[model samples]
Target: MSELTAFLSSNVVFGVWGGLVGLSLLVLAVDLHQKNAHLSPMMKFVWALTVLYSGPIGLGIYFYAGRKEIAHDSIWRRGFRSVAHCYSGCGMGEVLGVILTVGLLSLGNLWVALASFSLAYVFGFGLTMGPLMQEGETFSDAFNDALYSETPSITVMEVVAIGADLLLAGSAHMGQTLFWGALIFSLSLGLFAAYPVNVLLIKWGVKEGMMNPKHTPGNAAPQTA
Candidate 1:
């Protein structure tokens, strides 16, 4: 037990990675609850194994391939027609923002990076909360709405949060004098790497009209004759 504790304490990278994997699994659980109400026992077992072991890559694959097959038409295909239509006007902004933020950080301009990160964080968070705002509910209602309905937007926010955490970690990993520089560089790379994938998911959701404001959870109720 002592050895195990020591190993985990010393290995921050592994711990962070494991946390990310765990989060992916948690999201998978939420997806299962939302979309797999009629899945067989065997399929549930397979899903458990896939989510626990395969991590984020597994989540991506299942979302693109397996989940679509069993997913309800109301949940999966209720919105738009194609990926292209969804991704319109989503290009270059994220890429350029990341580049400029990182460049400033590399030049020891931590303030600039912090400002940019803050703005991006606010924008993403607000977008994630937009639906709830429209309803004029209490804080709890808005929070719950954001949690349950905004999966893609929530995922994007998580990516940014993870990038921020990584930036802090990179600072500590490097010396104090160079910490900001290293953090900026690391965050830049992370943003660039993740932005394209996010754009793709956005497109997928948009093409599917998954982001449409009219498609709320209440709208997904089964009809009775």
Candidate 2:
């Protein structure tokens, strides 16, 4: 506790910034739940998490791109949504894994990276499969779909995020501003890195983009221009 106090006192800028981020997340989460109820549960969580990390910029993006209703999902828009969806799960897993393995357990670098990657895959695949299973698909079928659809994006995201973390904060303690700052930068880069891959996947019909809440797997409605 005293160490945390010392860290925060020394990093006043980061402390203030973290406070603002927490406030932004609260606002975004409420707005999403109350006004954007049309979004899927997964999407709502994604948007909230995005805002939590990116703060005002993320909130602006949600208003500009996320809230608008698209009768036809352009390739670019579809790609953006796809990346956000994948990032939601992958980012959470990676951060948690790092916090647990690197921060808490103080594992070696290789072990920390492996643990982060493993958790990222698990959460990423689970998010993709969960909705399908909810809609009555067998576990085997849903797992296969998730494996095919999410693997590439998740892999790209994890590589960039973990690599950036290692490069930027390899020896920084968890309480250091460098650690969280590097994580935010790395996550943003990871999102961009996954975007093009997601676009390619959408182009190839390997995965679907951000789904409307009304969409069901078997009875998906066509988008209108």
Candidate 3:
């Protein structure tokens, strides 16, 4: 009983952020309602969980990596693959940010977030362009594609994720579990907030997913859906 009291009383900020999270969850429940016909039970769970965990990046990856089959050469699959590819780059950038934040330099929370956000988008665009270049896309053409496609999703993700971290942490030191837990929890909220926007992107037929990107030239990148 005392433990429960400690838990409830300690995280006042967490509770506030959690209210926002709850709102996102409500939004997700409604938005995903009609999407049920379009995806399998498992795929639906995958999509929901991805949103629950990683927000835009995970949503893009779901399409990019071909989590579900829409049809052969379906726009849905192609779009997902494209988004996933961008997320791959973002993932790399976030890794570097983590290194800067706590691993290599311990530059504190502010620098860590700034580094992560800036690097994530930068790497997201670059990574997308890299594969397109190998596929015979020129720098100009690839640049346009990367910038246009990834901007919306990545922006949504970074804003929400960063906002959550700062709100939860405030002035707290990084070594504490509460700080870390709040960050994770805040990300889940971010995912919830971003899920609907991703769904709209998928619906617009402007995106696609592939089973895998065969890094080598002359190898056909197989379509998963």
Top model number, TM-score: 2
Q: Which residue pairs clash in candidate 2?
A: none
lDDT for model 1 comes to 0.41
Candidate 2's error at 70, in angstroms?
A: 6.0
Order of models, best TM-score first: 2, 3, 1
Candidate 3 residues 1-225, lDDT tens each? 335323423567545645655655455455446332333343444445444445444544454444323334444454554444444455556546755676567677778788888998888787667767988999999989878767787777667766666666544445665555555555555444544555567677544433332232233346798
Candidate of highest lDDT = 2
Per-residue CA lDDT of candidate 1, range 117-210, in tens? 4454444444435544765876777656544433353244335533553444423322242333333333333333444444554456531233
Error in Å for residue 112 of model 3: 3.8
Better of 1 and 3 by TM-score: 3
> In order, what lDDT does every prediction score?
0.41, 0.78, 0.56
Which tens-of-lDDT digit does each residue in 1-225 have in candidate 2? Answer: 345433433567577777888888887777766756656666778788777766776676566557644354477777877787788888889899889987889988898799999998998888888889999999999999999999999999999999987777777778777778777767878888898999999899998777543452333355899
TM-score of 1: 0.28
Regions of candidate 2 where Cα sits further than 4 Å from its true position: 1-13, 69-72, 212-225
Q: Once superposed on the true structure, which residue ranges of model 3 sit more than 4 Å away at CA? A: 1-88, 102-110, 209-225
The ten-residue window of minimal lDDT in model 1 covers 81-90
